[model samples]
Structure formats: C-alpha cells, structure tokens
Target chain A: MSQLSGNTKWSVAKLKERSPVRWHERIGETSIFIISLASILLIMLMAIFILKEGLMVFINPSIRAEVNFRELFLKTVWQPISEVPKYSLLPLIAGTLKTSFVALLIALPLGMLAALFISECAPKWLSEFVKPTIELLAAIPSVVIGFFCLMKVASWLAHAYEIKWLHDALTPHRLNTLVGGIGISIAVVPITFTLCEEAFHGVPESYRAASIALGATKWQTALGVVIPTAMPGVIAAILLSFGRAWGETMIALMATGNAPLLDLNILHSVRTLAATVGAEMPEVVVGSSHYHVLFLIGTILLSISFTVNGLSQLAISSLRKKLTGG
Target chain B: MNANRRRFRLPKGSEASGLALTLLSAIATLIVLSMLAIILVDLGSGGYRKLSWEFLTKPPEQGMTGGGIFPAIFGTMFLVIIMTLMVMPVGVLTAIYLNEYAPKHALITRLIRTSISNLAGVPSIVYGMFGLSFFILFLGRRIDSLIGAELLFGQPCLLWAAATLSILTLPVAVTATEEALAAIPEELRLASYALGATKWQTIWRVVFPKAMGGILTGAILTVSRGAAEVAPLLFTGVAYYLPQLPLSPTSQFMHLGYHIYVMATQSPDVEATMPLQYATALVLLALTFLLNLIAILIRVRLRIIAGEV
Candidate 1:
C-alpha cells in the first residue's frame, strides 16, 4: 500500500514536470483556442468590410456628391441607372416590411397551431410523421421555393382572381407582394413550426400534471398553463421567423416581380432590399455609387438580422432561466 | 357529493372544446403538410419528363433553353467538396474547444457563443456582400499584389466562393458537433482521464473516435447547407453559364441553384426553359433532402447507441 501511494505521488510529480507531451498539450489547447476565435474574427471582418464599403455612400466625397444620405432615405424613387441616378430605400423598405409582415401574418397562426398539435395533441406516430415532413419543407432550397412561387403560385393566384370575391381578396399581378409573401411563408413556416414545437416541448411535465389534476381539460391546460409558461419561447420563434422572412433573398428575388414600386396595395409588384442586392449586385460596376448603395442595403440587412437575432436569443435565454429556475 | 360513491367523477363539458381545439390544430398541420406535398408533387410531375440520362450527362445547348445541367452539378460538387474540407476542421475544433476545453462562464466563451448564433442569423445576401468586398476585392487584391499576378486572385472564383460558403455554414457544423459532443456522457471522459492519458491524447484517441458519428453528421449537414446557397455564390464565384468546369481554384463555376434562378428569371424564353428550371430545382432538392435524411439517420443511430431513445 505504501509503495502504491509512493508510486502515485511520483507519477503526479512527473506529470507536473515539463515534458514534450506537456508541450504538445499546451500547443493543442492554444491552437484550438485560436481556431475557436475564427468565428468572432470572421464576424468582425464581415462587419468591418461591409461597413467600409457600405458606409462609402455617406463618407466618400464622390459618392456623396452623387447619392447623398438624404436621397437614400427620403427619396421614393430608386432609379440608379437613369441619366441622373437616384438612390432611394423607401420603396425597398416598404416592400420588405409589407411582404415579411404578410408572411408572418399567414405563418404565425398556422405554425403555432401546428406546433401545438405536434407537441401537445398528436399521438407519437402522428407527431413523428409530421415533424420530419415540416423539416423537409425547411430542406427545400429558397431558390426552389422561389421557382415554385413564380411558376405555380403566381398562375394560381392569377386564375383565382377571375372569381368576384376572390378577385376582391387576391392580388391581380402574377408576381405580386401577396404571392411573394405566400412563398416566403412556405420557407418561414417550417422554422416557426420547429421552434414553436421546441418551445411547447420545453414546458414542464409537472405543470401539465398539476393542471390536469385540477380537472382542467387537455386544451385548457395547453392554453392556460403550458403556452403561458412557454410564451417567451413562442415569441422567440415568431421573431426568428420574421427575421428569416426579412432576410430571404432568392424567394423575394424571384417571386416579388423585382419592381421597386412604392405601393401599399398587396396586389402591386414590389421589390425587397435583399432581392435588390441579389439581383443588382452582380452587374453593378465595382466602386460605383450603385455598388456602394447595394452594400449599404446589405449593411441595413445585417443590422436588422443582428437585432432580431439578439432579441430572439434574449427571449430564449430568459425562457431557459425561467424553466430551470437558475 | 354522493355518500354511496367512493370515487369522484369529473365533469365532461370541457371535452368538446378540447376536441374542437385538437381538430383545429390538426387542420393547421394538415394545411402545412399538404403544402409540402403539393410542392413536391408538382415539381416531380413537371420535371419528370425532362429528367433523363442524357439530361443528366450533357451540357446546355441553344442558350440553355435545351441542355443538361452537368456543369452545374460538377461545379456544385466541387464547391461543396472544398467547402467541406475547410469547414469541418475549424467547426469541429471550435465545437471541441467549447464543449471540452474552455472554462465555463468565461467572457471569450460567451462571445463565441453569441458570434456563432449571429453568424447563423446573418442574411445570406449579406454574406454575398462580404464575400464580394472582403474575400474578392480586399484579400484577393492583396494576394494578387503580393504574387505579382495581374488579375488571377482578385477576381471572383472557386476558392473565394468555397471560403464564403464554409463561413456561412460554419454555425451549422459547429452546432451539430456541439450537440454530438454534449451527448457524450461525462463518465467516459472521466474514464479516459483516469487512465493517465493526457488531455490531448484522450481528445485525439478516445473522444474523437467516439464522436465520429456526430462529426460525420455535421459534415453532411454542412455540405447540404452549403450546396443550396445561391446568393453568396452569385458575387463570389458562380457563373451564369460556364462552358468549362472550374478546373482550378481561381476559375468561376456553375451551380444548380444559380442555374435555376437564372433560367426561371432571365432565360431568353422563360416558357421554353420552364421544364429545365423544374428539373434543376428537383435535382437540387433531391441532393439536400438525401443529405438531411442521412444526417437524421445517423443522429437517430447515435441516440440509439447512447440509449437516449
């Protein structure tokens, strides 16, 4: 026993002594630590580089002489290729908000209810079938979703407009904001469904038990106890999905008719900030005010996404704390 | 209360509302599911006739209104292969560092977590802008200047596209890998340490092998995610129509998503290319779907092995 104890102490001493293995261990940890910082570095670089290029619209003397900050914000027209180029963000912002809000309006109720069903009401076999099906919806590429909207949904909506009541409700443009909103919702709903399902699942079983023991019906427990407990997570889900709809490019590019029309009617064809960048960035001359304006649009998009994501993260973390009581 | 009865009977009035709510939500789920079904069936039917062996193997002819998407397929594969190579190591290592090395509650740890979440949320179009400004113009120009090249590195090409894509998908790879790493029980790590193995040795020899399934899932998910992105690649390297494959890192390439986008929106005759668009979309969808299915299967197997399911 003494020998064993002495041997253990000697090994510990040896481990503490500087060795090649120790050197490798130090190198490995340090290398991984550096590698781990790559994400932060990339994000910083992205912000810096985008800001450098994007802010040129305001900072560069030549660019400002042509397209000033006031024109970008206040001017309604976005014609950048005419003899006297104009750079306005109002139409794009209006289009983006309209389409994304419409998408949320369509997606929120359906996604929340579907998630409620999958989480609380469905049988095991049924939930399993529904869950992956929704995930498959997510796996569909944005480009594909965009194509579907352009080809089928547009035609369907155009056809539906022949009916008097449907004509009153539906957009007449083949590729209108309404069609774009529906297309974006196809992409947004899956995310909303998945996240809301997770939120519902996160509700404690004991909470449900207590509600049930109080003679509450299943729906009453789900509504009165479970959903209230998971409200933050639900909000996070909706916010994240809204962020997704806002940032979506391919769907907006293909489905929204790419027209920068500042119109309130959902039937009017509209353009989005993201789609403008996607559609116009490839052709714009390098270092031109047009290019910088696109980058400015990108900067706006990045900030919006960051803010929304931060809000969602806050909601999620708060929910975690509330659930765990930590 | 009835004196004769021992058990209490619950009121049945609320059951109707419960059933009604269930029915309503079930309808919602049904609507969502039918949407997916409609998309798949429509695309499958529309593209079915055009999807042939010749269509898969040949190149486009007559201004892309009639042709196969072989170049797009090749380019997508090349892009994803390089992207997978770049992302897997950094992403897996970052995950390892987070799950195993970093001290809990450290500021650096929180920053990294926040950055990863934000990275995942940054719009894909913004990634395209960054790819153009940072990767192509700035870094590429610097490289060209250093190498005394005229325009090779300063132009949009495969390397920068792959690099941009790898960054965009980094969060996916990291999150998946972290989940896998966390799934590993604490006792296993304790056992490895108890064997007098160094931290590096245990991480390399024991932990890595055990985490292989998760790593593979991360890799596949990364590939699938990177392969489908069109916006970032648009300015980075993707070409509208590349007659030649991206034989070198500095060469521009074609992609299925970009192909579909251009064909549907910009083809000379959109009606003529409609079938081609649908076919290309189908191919892209199949690739991503297959990859996701594989990842899910691997995860399910891992869960089974870990006795979690």
Candidate 2:
C-alpha cells in the first residue's frame, strides 16, 4: 500500500512538470503565428488603402468632368500643363509599347543565340565566365545605364544612322524613343539570356545524344529538339523582360525625350506612365486631384505588372508539369 | 549517288567570320569597359585639375559651384549609418521568424512571402509617398532632422531620410537573409534539437553565425542600392547645399545622390561647371560599383566556406 502511494505521488509530480512546459511552448508558437499574421495584414491594408484612394479620382464627378474618360483612353495627346489639360494616354502608351517591342525584337534573337552559344557551343570554362558576367548586368543600377545612354548612346545613334528624316524629326532634342529602346534592350538582353541559357542547359543530355546519333547536325539538334523543349521558359523570360521594360522609370525619365506629346515616330521624344509618376509624384500637392491621379496611375501600373507576372508564373508551372508529366 | 553527294556538300566559311563572332562578344565587354573609360576620361579632364584637399574639406561656398562635397559626403554617411541600424534588426528578426519559427502550412507564411515579392516591385517613389504621409504628416513630427526635437536636434530633423531608406531596403534585406537562413542544413537543426537545446537557442547559437556571411553580403548590397537612390530622398529631405558640416547626429547635411541630380537637372548654373556634374556622376558610379564588388566577393567567399564545411 505504501509503495502504491509513492508511485501515485511520482506520477502527479511528472504531470505537474510537463503541463507548464507544454503550455509555454504553445504560447510561444501562438505569439509567432500572430506576429506573422499581423505583418501580412499590414501589407494587405496598405494595398487596400492605395486602391481606395486611387478610385476616388474616378468616382468624384468634379474631377472626372475636367478630363473625359474616353479622350483619356483613345486620344494620343498627354499635355498636362496646357489650357485644356488633355490627359490622353495614347501617346505615352504608344511610346511605351514601341520601345518595349523594339527592345524585345532586338533582345529576343540575340538572347536566344547567346544562350545557344553559351550552353552548346562554348567550353565549360567559357560558360562559367559568360553566365556570371551576364548576371552581373542585372545587378547594375538602371540609373547608371540611363546616365550612360544619355551621355553616349544617344549621340552614337545620331552619328551612326545619320538619316536626314530622323535628324529632322529629332531636331531640338538628341534623346528619343529609339535611344530609350536600345538602352532598355541592353538591360533586358542579359536577363533573357540568363533564363534561356538555364532552360536550354536543363534539357537532358540524352536527348541531344539521341538526335546526334540519328545523324542530325549539332545546330539541328539544338534548334529542332532543345529549343522546342525550352520554348515555354523562353517565353517566360520574354514576358519577364517585357514587364521590366514597361515598369522601368529612371532610364525612361533620363533618356526619353520628356515630351508628353502623341507622336508615334521612334525618333520623336515621348514619355511613359512610369516616368510621369516618378517625375510628378514628388511635387504633387497633398489631397489634390493630381495626387489622386498619380495614385490611379500607380494602381494601373500595379495591375498591369501583376497580370504579366501572373501569366509568366502560370506558363512556367504548366511547362514544368508538362515536362515532368505530373 | 555517293560521289554526287560529296560534291554537293557546302563549303565552310573562312576563319574571318569566326573571328567576327568572337569580336562581337568582345564588343559587348567593351560596352561596359567604355562606360568606365568615358567616366574616367571626363573626370580626369575636368575634376582632376580642380579636385584638391579643400574640395574634400570645405563647405558649400556659393550654391555648390565653389564648395567641396564635405557636407554631402557627411550627410550620406549619416543617413547610411542610421538606415543600417534601423533596418538590420527588424529585417534580420523578420527573416528569422520566417525561416525558423513560422509553420510551413500556415497562410501567414505564404502571405509574407507574396508581400515581400510585391514589395520589391513597388517603386521607390511610392515609399516616399508613404514616408511623407505617415512619418512626416500624420505623426505631427519634424521629418527632416536625424533626431528631431526629442533630443539632439531640438528641432525637426533630416533623419527621416534614413528612416525612408530603411523601408526602401527592408525587402532586399529580408529576401537575402531568408536565402541565407534557408541554406543552413536541416540536419544541423535536428542535431541541435537532439542535444536538448531550445529552438531559440539553436537558432541564435548555431544558425545565425553560420548565416552571418550571407546576411552581411545582403546588407552590403542593400546599402549600395540605397546609396544610389535619389527620387525618394527628394521628398524625404536632402538639401541642395548645407553651409556647415554635419558634425553632430542632429545636424542636417546634403547628400551626393541628391547633389548629382540637382546639378544635372535642376541647377540654375549648369554651363560653367557642367564638368563638375560629370565628376559627381563618376563618383556615384564608382561608389555603386565598389559596393557591388564587395558584396559579390563576400558572397563568393561564404559559398566557398559553405562548400568546404
């Protein structure tokens, strides 16, 4: 009976010791959970506030009366300082599109060819050197690139092309959309090349060997088999580069002729939505229509970029599934 | 048929074409090299003749045309130091929470990750807006001085610039720190747990030290990026010219990034000292490049160490 009582006492002591420890662990875990949740909530709150403030510009009839929504959408003029103050987005949109498309046109072939050269044609040592050097380009600041373009590339283009028509089109200012496009191409090429190279390298060596054993040339095997398999990744790279080009501000602000006019010619000066926001947001008076309009622009930019990024991510995942059959 | 097939084969191009292809790569390299070269040449022709000991030491004499970069340099250093202090703790702690403490299946974990990615996409100008609204206006405090009326400045302070930069760099620091933390092996954690160490203790003692090199690399990169940024500072408060040195933490000072921007674009006197603008650009570029090199070096060293271990 005494031994049984002693055993009961021991069991009680063990339970008492373990209960507090478990309680403390639970408390700690719960606190961490709350903190993490709070951080996320804060971000969501910021996004919601931005959207709410931005929408107010459209909802207020007094503000909307000043600038017709249709004209803003369809018209190409973007003079914000004139008597009428037309807010036509077409000129900016066209400028942005032209520059980005030209950039893609230049970067796409070069990036793919560079990827092919690095992954297939080059020696391993050369591959290692080239890969990191290309990545280093991504790390360089956009502002530095902008400075270089403003100082040198614009002048170089003027000298090289020397087209009388182009010169006439860009008489007063040296910087133009074409110069912006070329500068942006320099930035985008490295990123696309890196992604494409990785994708190409990811293709199994056995496939290449099989194509070669079937008597295909090295170039044929690469072009016919490797490039096809890596198409989705290459597309993803292109989309990513597109998004970056669209969102870029410093280079656009510095190099693009800040003329907010509706000219479609590549040699003419133009401005993008991002550059406008960067240039004007700092000086915008608090709670003014201009401030709300800037916010609206931000909202548009965010949504557009989000869509592009989402599409790229979706493409990448689907490609992964297709490749793995999973 | 075989004899005809051999006759129909295409001839190889001359070695000249191969040389041209190789030259194309060399030209790409030259693009980067020439930027450096142009900056050097411009600075050498303009600033090399003018730069003296006084240029480094003197205050602005007449709206930056006559003065050295003393105040701007001091201001930049001050802002960087304060920003580092503010960001390092919060960023590192948040990274620790994500990597070590948070549960894998939790929605909060996923949300934090998404928010970080989105935050990185947000332009620097947006951060300036946030700082103006929240820190300067809503808080009803002096937004310019380092310490404000609370202590040293006895007035509204310029330290708000540093605070603004801290937010600007937080995402970078968090992403980098998380990457570093993630690199630590699960086996290390398990061993620590098996030894009866607490989770916090294991993280503090084993994981943090191992991850320090990467974290430092991230910090360096963040600082470099912060140093180059100008648009946000225009709103946060960096003066074009400061007459006095930023001797105290409370004293307001000029910054090189802002100085360069103002000199290049907004300055009333551009013709006489346009070369000064180029020299400033060279300085900014060199600073950014040096920081990048340092960060890369640290990252490479850490990777080597990790591999050896």
Candidate 3:
C-alpha cells in the first residue's frame, strides 16, 4: 500500500508538473458548487417572492387603502371578501394558537409518555413494534389525516355530543377547534415521540447504570435522571411540534370549518393562518388585496416556522454537546 | 454527598409508582397505536369493496360520484416522475458537495445547512404560496414574456407543480444521500486517491456506486412525498377535474390528494361520494405506504452495509 501510494504520488507530481492546470477538476468542483447552491438559491427566492408579494398589503396603493399593518396586527376580524374587506390577522393568530394549544395539550403528555415507555420501560420487542408503528403513522399524509378527521373523527365527536352527561365537555360544532386539534395532534405525536425518544436515548447509559447501582428503581431513575437531563430535547420537541401544528394546513382546513370566529370556545370553529391560505387562496382573485393578504399569511407562517425550527435546532445541538460531551 | 444520597433513595411506594407510570405509558402507546389502527381499519373496510381494476383504470363518472379515479392516479404518477427527474440530480449532487467536497466548518457550508433545515420546516402551504408567486407569477410569466407567448407558460401547469414539489422534497433526498455518503469509510477514498484517481473520478467511479442504494432510497422517498403533497399544487397546476391527461408540461393535471380534498369539501353531494372518497384515500395511502416501506427496507440494507464499512 505504501509503495502504491508513493508511486501514485510521484506520477501525480510528474503529471502535475507537465500540466499546471487541471481544468476538468476545477470545472467539476465549480459545477458541483453551483448545483449545491440551488437549495440556498431556492430558499432565498422563496423568501424574496413571498415577502415581496406579502408586503404588498403595505406597499400597493389600493391594497394599502383597505389594509395596513395596523389593520393586519391590531384588528381582530379576518373577513377579506366582504364589501369592507377586513384583513386583520388576530383572528387567524388566535385560531392558530387555539388549535396548536389543543394539539400540544393532548400530544405532549401522550408523546412524552410513549417516548418514556419505549425508551426506558418497554421491552426490546415491544419497542421494535412501537417505533415502526410510529414511523408508519408519520408517513401517513396530512391530507389523509384531514380526510379522516373530516369524515370519521368529526362524526364520532358529533355522536359523543349525543350522550347527555358529556354535552358540556364536547363541542357542539361537528367540525371545530377540538376536532382540528385532535387531527393535528395525530400528525404531531410521531414527531414528538421521535425527538423525545432520541433525547431519552441520548442520556448516557452510565447515568442509568449509576442510578441503578445506587439502588434506585428503574422508573425512579427515568423520571428523576433521564427525563430531566433530556428536558431540553423534550422542550425542543414540544416547540417543534407546536410549530408543526401551527403551520399544519389540510387538517385544519378540513376539520376546523374555516370560520374566523374570535371565540374562546374549543367547540367553536376557527380558521388558522395556514388553513386560511389553503381554503381561500385558490378562489382568491389574483393580484387583489386578498391575494396579497394570503401571501402575507404565508409570510407569517414562514417566519414562525423558521424561528421555531431554528430555536429547536439550537436546543438539540446544545443537548447533543451536553449529553455527548462533544 | 448527603444531597446525592437523598436523591437516589428508594422511597416507599416507588415500586407502585413505577408500575403505575409504566401502565400509564403503555396505555398511551396503546392509544397512539389505536389511532393508526382505527384509520387503517376505517379506510380498508370502507374502501375495499370500492377498489377494483375498473376503479383503478376508469375515469370518474357523474361528477366524481360514481366511477374510478384513473386520471388522478395517472397524474400523480406523472407528477412524481417529473419531480424525480428534477430533484434527483440536484439533490444527489448537493449531498455530494456537502459530504465529499465541502470544507468542514466553512461559513458557506453552514449557510447551506441552515437553508436546507429551514426549507424542511417551511409549511407545505407556504410552498404552495411560494410556487404561486415565484414560479407561476414571476418565473413562468417571465418565460412567457421572453417568448412573447400569451399566458402559455404563465399559468399553473404540470412542470411548475413538479418544480414546487421538487424543492419541497430536496432536503429529504440530500439528507438520505449525505447519510449514505458519510457511511463510506475514509480508507476507500484514500485507496482511490492512491490509485491515481482524481477526486471527481473517485466519487464517480468508486463512491457513487456504493451510494447508489442510498440514492435510490432518496428517490423513492422523494417520489412518495411529491405524490402525497397537495397544498402546493392547490394553485400551482392541479386542476379540479381535467378532461384530458396532462400530456404536456404546460398542461394542468389531476392529483389524488386534491381529488379527495375537493370531493370531501366541495362536492355537492358529499354523502353520495363517500365511498369514492374512501377508495381514493386508500389508493393514495397505499401508494405512499408501499413507497415508504421500500425506502425503509433499502435503508435497513444500507445500514447493514454501512456497518460492514
């Protein structure tokens, strides 16, 4: 091997001496560099175009007459098709928050408990079964989840309302914030489970060993040591899932009844920012204020997702360094 | 020492608490599993009778209330094909650059990583919005103006939707290929170098073949993603119902997800089309599921090979 290396190095040097430039290699590197830049380029163009069109609500004269930053941020109604055409983002924001709140309320505990079960409690065979089941669940498309929520979950909730005692607890609306939240939670749980499981897995084996060596019970060690050490990751998971539920479109559009109601009732149908875009963008007049407003909603979704994902990335990296001693 | 000692103590009822928590999480897992099970059972039982060769091959009849969803299946396949052609070359090359050519810890590399992660996190509807504004209104219209065509390239069509979806799934391909590339031992590249192979030659001749499985996995995953995506296509190119197949890149196409969405929401007689909705959903769910299963199997095989490496 050394001889081969030496002979190749000598020949390569001689060859290089003969030809001072390797044009093909340089071209190859440059082309690959350009191709690799496409992702960055695409992302930049996405931000630019989305921002340009979205910000038209402020810049365009006609759009500005009907809508302004104050109307978008300060006002509460989101009726963009009326004669007056209000474009306040507060209702949509409230809707996004309410649905995400319901999603997190259900998903957080279930996801964390499932992660705990798989990582620290379940047998190996059981973990194997559960992990792939979660993956399969993750692979199920959002649209299908939306369809299911629309067809089955809503009907089931409606039926649940029929029982006299459960009336107060249930939403009277068949398709409401609670139903959308449940649908989003289905999408959110796999993500939460995967991330939290990784976090739990990242807690070094020695930590568990030491805790066990000290005569601590398995659940005691898990609850006291592993979960706490992995708390940042769990938090990151929750944040990421929140971002997901916040930006989720199809399920919300399908299940939430597409009403921009500013009510606090979980049973009341609400329209989310993402869902509003999906539900309205197709029918919206091109180049109208409504079009720009939808784009603006897109802008809001883009920025919120970017921020949430960035923070989660930071949390994961910090957790990695702390737990892995990197 | 005293604090540490107290912290690790096996207090009374610890065992019972352990049992209770374990049972509780097990129930949580059961609920999650049942969620999957309920959807599958509902879709399968509801859709099974409706699915047939005729249903798979024939076009919808009576305003999508009666007949099959052949056009949706065809358009989805066509969309996936176009997207695969567009995404694979760029996605694989991006992975090659990041894993093989990138200077470690460089600023530009960090920028690319950040961009990819952000792209992955951007909502699908945002992609739809971006596609509408950027690809359709901006780039497509520019092409139309350059060629002096009247609304030819400016409208939503198969090409633009595929382009939008390609970008959305680019990170999936890049990540998978990077994982595959990273798994190759450093010694292999060194050996190729020692044989007087240039960097490009080594990657093309030696590393690329070894990473082929990973690339295939990426392709399958990308195809499945493109097939499943409907939000971005809402405005880009997908039609509510096209009379003819999208035989050209410039033409609009039907999509399975959009079909289901439109039928479930906009159909005048939602009750009449319930069976058709279930069948279409099942077909879509099965397509994505099968593709994902293939990808996972390939991934597991790659892992075994990577372990050997």
In the order shown, the candidates' DockQ scores are 0.69, 0.25, 0.76
For A1-326, candidate 3 gives per-residue lDDT tens digits of 99999999999789889866678888988999999999889999999999999888888998888888899889888888888889889999999999999999999899999999999988988887789789889888889999999999999888778987677664478899999999999999998999999999989999999989889889989988899899889989988898888999889989998899898999889999998998889899899999998988888899998999899989988888888778
lDDT tens digits, residues B117-193, model 3? 98989999999988888888889999999999999889999999999999999999899889878877889999999
Candidates in order have lDDT scores of 0.91, 0.71, 0.90
* lDDT per residue as tens, model 2, B1-309: 999777544336534554565556445544533434554564456556556678767776666677677777778878888888887776777788899987776787777776665666556665565555555654434432444544442222466667767877878888889899999999999999889677766887899998998899889878887887765666666677766666665456688766766676567876765666666666666677778788887877787877852
TM-score of each: 0.95, 0.82, 0.95
Worst 10 residues of 1 chain B by lDDT: B3-12
lDDT of 1 by residue, A1-326 (tens): 99999999998788778444577679879999999999999999999998888988888999989988689889899998899998999999999999998899999999999999999989998987788778778888899999999999999888777888766764467789999999999999999999999999999899999988977778888998989999999999988998899999999999999899998888889999999998889889999999999999988999999999999999999999999999
Q: Per-residue lDDT for A28-96 in model 2, tens only?
A: 556655654544654565566556666777798877876667866887677666577777777777777
Stretch of 10 with least lDDT, candidate 2 chain A = A36-45
Tell the DockQ for candidate 1.
Answer: 0.69
Off by over 4 Å in 1: A1-21, A164-171, B1-13
Cα displacement (angstroms), candidate 3, residue A274, comes to: 0.8
True interface contacts reproduced, per candidate: 0.83, 0.09, 0.76
Cα lDDT tens digits for candidate 1, B1-309: 585343434456678877889999999999999989999999999998899998888999988888799999999999999999999999999999999998889999999999999999999999989988998999999999999999998999999999999999999999989988887788888898898777788888888889899889888888989988998987898998877778999999999999999888887798888888889999998899999899888888988888877
